[model samples]
Target chain A: MSASLKSLPSNPAFTLPQSNDVQGTTSASGPHIPAEFEQTLTLLTSHRSVLGYLLLSRSQPVSIIRHSGVVFEGEQGRKYAHAVGRIVETVQAGLEEVAGESTDTDEIRFMRIRTKRHEIMISPDERFLLAVLHDPTS
Target chain B: MSASLKSLPSNPAFTLPQSNDVQGTTSASGPHIPAEFEQTLTLLTSHRSVLGYLLLSRSQPVSIIRHSGVVFEGEQGRKYAHAVGRIVETVQAGLEEVAGESTDTDEIRFMRIRTKRHEIMISPDERFLLAVLHDPTS
Candidate 1:
């Protein structure tokens, strides 16, 4: 996998120390994120099934940052952060089956799957991958 | 991280050689899946944004099978099947932060997150977890 496995801080202390404070990095990258990402987040959160979301940039530094729009904390926060990176790698590796000869539409925009106890949602682009975990029953 | 890394068959040939036919094992386990699980799958697929879904059991055998209620196939089929086994393992390892000494309520039932390009929805239960992957853009 090309992704780095750096663990995100349990809190905000893990912010990058470089000239780009977390917010600057986030906004500069924010335009790259689509508008619908949050619209869907609103839909899921309104349903109360959503736990939280993590945004990971594959560009560099391999960041595992939580979505500022929602309150994702504690053990659950860390778990989603970790899952985002792995999911991106897995999808990237697995895409060989679909990419075919068309290089233009090679990126994966979204994916959803379930485990015995929880649901996982993922959206990816050239620069970052976004994942949402939620349950409709809750 | 208690999740077993057992690989789900890349193809149907990997079916458990242990006296279980494909249909037999599914029906034996089918009773555990919630009606709400399918309901959500229907909702997501109905939306043009939905790409596909994979439902996996946390119990042994790490099956990466799709539900009978939903038709998940084509290029995405191969991708999610490949993903199921790895995702279960990832989530299990990631859950350490939240599954504390608290009561039943401490565990998360549902979660949703998104990045700029995609969205992932997850619903988890004691017996299994259901995940739906979709794009609001599509």
Candidate 2:
């Protein structure tokens, strides 16, 4: 696993030094917010599954701002329970088929499998994940 | 100056495992592009000034991209010029007025100031800044 990992070449890996930091000020009175932030937010917001995964993993409700600039806050986990639950249900069914019983052992195994899938989806965009976690109420 | 820098907290940094090297056999398969590549392109495309700074410091162009989706290609010098230009036009403008010199040297400095500003505003986001020894554009 260690052999497969590639390192990021840049200094200050995730933290971007904005114009304000470079100029040593609270804000740089520029004509516009840098396009990068806008693009990043767009990418993050575009993926609904990522948002759903976040809310589920954090075990917290979240608000998603639509592309039209309207914000919608809700318990995404509860709302998407059917789809996600179906996935969980399917996994449970598979385990029962193999093990011939829905024992305590099967429940634990199913939970681990579900958790692993959720983790795999959420692992890649850690910065966006942090941003969502750190989002101030709005 | 270095003493003013704050140290990061003792939390272990998260590491993402890379499954493949550059141009690896792993094919892209997902609802979205691989997060690693998405981040690299996003960082490169978005933070032109930072890229410029890196390029300037290195004095040579570099190219990077992996099967994971990160792609960057550019010279450091050009990026530096753009960053310097942005700094001059935006942050350094106030400083220039404070200095208040209208000599030929001052005019040359002012022209340099304007050129950097213009380069950042007008250039394509993906285009690399090329450093010219005598001419600002060679």
How well does candidate 2 score on lDDT at residue A53?
30
Q: Find the 10 residues in a row with the least total lDDT in model 1 chain B.
A: B1-10
Tens-place lDDT digits, model 2, residues B53-122:
1212111232212211111123333333433334323322322332246332211111111121121211
Regions of candidate 2 where Cα sits further than 4 Å from its true position: A1-78, A100-105, A109-138, B1-20, B26-138
Model 1 C-alpha lDDT per residue in residues A1-138, reported as the tens digit of each score: 111211111111221222222232346545434444445445444434556666666654346644633445654555556556665665555444334465643345445444445555565655565666554345
- RMSD per candidate (Å) reads 13.4, 25.3
TM-score of chain A of each: 0.55, 0.26
Clashing pairs in 2: B37-B69, B37-B70, B52-B79, B52-B80, B55-B76, B55-B77, B56-B76, B56-B77
Give lDDT for model 2. 0.25
Question: Residue by residue across A32-61, what tens digits does model 2's lDDT show?
Answer: 324554554455455433332322221123
Question: Model 1's DockQ?
Answer: 0.14
B3-92: candidate 1 lDDT, tens digit per residue: 121111011111112222122223664643445455545554454445666566655554554552233465455445545445455555
Find the candidate with the highest lDDT and give its number.
Answer: 1
